[model samples]
Target: GLRNYVQMFTEDPRYWRSVVTTLTYVVIAVPLQLALALVVALALKGMKRGKAFYRSAFYAPSLLGASMSIALVWRAIFNDGGTVDHLSGTGGWVNKPGWALLAVALLTVWQFGAPMVIFLAGLQQIPAELYEAAACDGASKWRQFLSVTVPMLSPVIFFNLVLQTIQAFQVFTPAFAVSAGKGGPADSTLVYTMYLYDRGFVASHMGYASAMAWVLLVVIGAVTAVLFRTSRSWVFYASEGDR
Candidate 1:
């Protein structure tokens, strides 16, 4: 058992590729996704009309993000001679390693609706009096946002950060479907879970796959622990109650 686990790190180059690819997704997709979501949430919060319709419209993508149909649609859009290439006058991005990964990241980033809703709720919960006081102090809109908006939103930001980071690491369906279940054009889009599926199902390497699953769990757990440990310095709660 232990030997098989060790061999995954030492004997398998594909394993390392999966690790790097998953980290790439986490690093590239999660922050951009959250940032866009926060911006949308802030915009929605400031709107006076058609709020429900706009919220639902913005949220539709997250509802269908994991659906097989969306993946197929994405594949069509990025495939050779597809819409992206047709519009850009460039070659297909799907078959290229770096570009393919970016295409997959784009899919993840597009599904920011859930976090946006969460942020919207969090923004609403912040007392308007805080902003009023900030404005009374002659704070500009940008300064008020940096001081009042962000501090109040810290807890929500931390919540979304942890949840999205975990979700990003587990991203499999987009890569699997976009690559047509092969993680191909040279394993560039082979995320960790995709590789695990290939190992356990396609290659029949159940032992190695199981080892990989456990390692992934450990890695996520360690990262989460670090986040939680550091959160005390940044994540603010109104109920911290004095000092």
Candidate 2:
């Protein structure tokens, strides 16, 4: 009933916290991941040597990052006295609420391989003649990138932005595995999906869980709609002619 849905917000404190955490994760992870991916894509596009090796090496993380095993590996690395602690000469990060989320964000950013590859493909499709013309007009390399590379690749950038935003909101494995399924350390790592799982399965409040799921779906749809609408200003399709 709609009453149950209302209670999800009014009666639930954890639900709101989860919402904040999820949004924070999306805000922090998606842009950083996309930016790093773009840099990597640009680097790969300019490389004349070992491109294949570098591409494979960079992309390997996205292939295995979402797996249970990799999540466990992430947990170990962030846990007390784990690899990061050993390397940084500090105590465990995963046990803390603030740092644990950052650790998870790092893991998310590290899996930028998929978008990087897509960006590389987009870069390859850009016409080289445009760059030559820009150079002839006395444009600097930076100016050329701003004028040519960005506009040409805007479509691809929009694609990755929308896709990664959706993916970021659905992040569950990292929170689940890294927090040991409890969203512990004071539930700071508890994401939207994790809270939904607890409500549906652990707490046996399936109705609330359903409400949360529907809300999430609506949120994603609305965000996507907004992106598509605003994209007319920024996302330049090739058919629209050069801006």
Candidate 3:
């Protein structure tokens, strides 16, 4: 049992590559998704008409995000000479090592509705008087966003970041479906969870996969703990003064 654990790290260079690929995916996908979500939430917050319809339309993709059918659809779009190719003229995305992971990341980004709703709720909870005060003090819109909106929304942002980061770490289906379960082209989309699945189920390295599973749990816990630890510096509570 323990031998597999030690050998997984010591014996396989792919373990390190998977770690790098996983982190890259998380870094690219989570921030972009949250940024897009926040932007959409802000736009929705200011809208006076057709809010429900627009929200539903945007969120519908998230409902189908994890489905195999959507993944297949995404594959079709990003494959050689597909819709995206016709628009961007960038050719296919999933067949090139440099672009395959980005295609997978984009699939995750397209499902930003859940976080957008959460951000919208947070935005709604913020007192309008705060923005009024900022404006009264001659703050520009950008300054007001930084000083008022971000501070007020920090908690919600942190919440989304944690959830998204955790979700990104477990990403497998999109990569699997897009790459046809092979983690190609050239293993660019071989995220940690996919590699774990490959080792355990495909290669029959159950012991190694089990070891990797425990490590992943530990790494996630440690990352969460680190985020909490560092959050004290940036995450502010409205009741902080009471402490």
Residue-wise C-alpha lDDT for candidate 2, range 1-243, written one tens digit per residue: 687578658878888889999999998899999999999999999999999999999999999999989998999999998999999877778898778888888889999999999999999999999999999999999999999999999999999999999999999999899999988788888999999999999999888888889999999999999999999888888886744
Give every collision pair in model 3: none
Q: Candidate 3's residue-wise lDDT over 165-206, tens digit each?
A: 899999999999999998899889999999999999999988
The TM-score values for the models, in the order shown, are: 0.97, 0.96, 0.96
The runs of at least 3 residues in candidate 2 whose Cα sits more than 4 Å from the true structure, single-residue gaps closed, are: none
lDDT of each: 0.92, 0.92, 0.92
List clash counts for every candidate, in order: 0, 0, 0
Instruction: Please provide, for model 1 over 14-132, each residue's C-alpha lDDT reduced to its tens digit, 9 standing for 90 to 100.
Output: 88988998998899999999999999999999999999999999999999999889988999899998999999977788888879988999999999999999999999999999999
Compute the lDDT of residue 185 as modeled in candidate 2. Answer: 80
TM-score of 3: 0.96
- Candidate 1 collision pairs: none
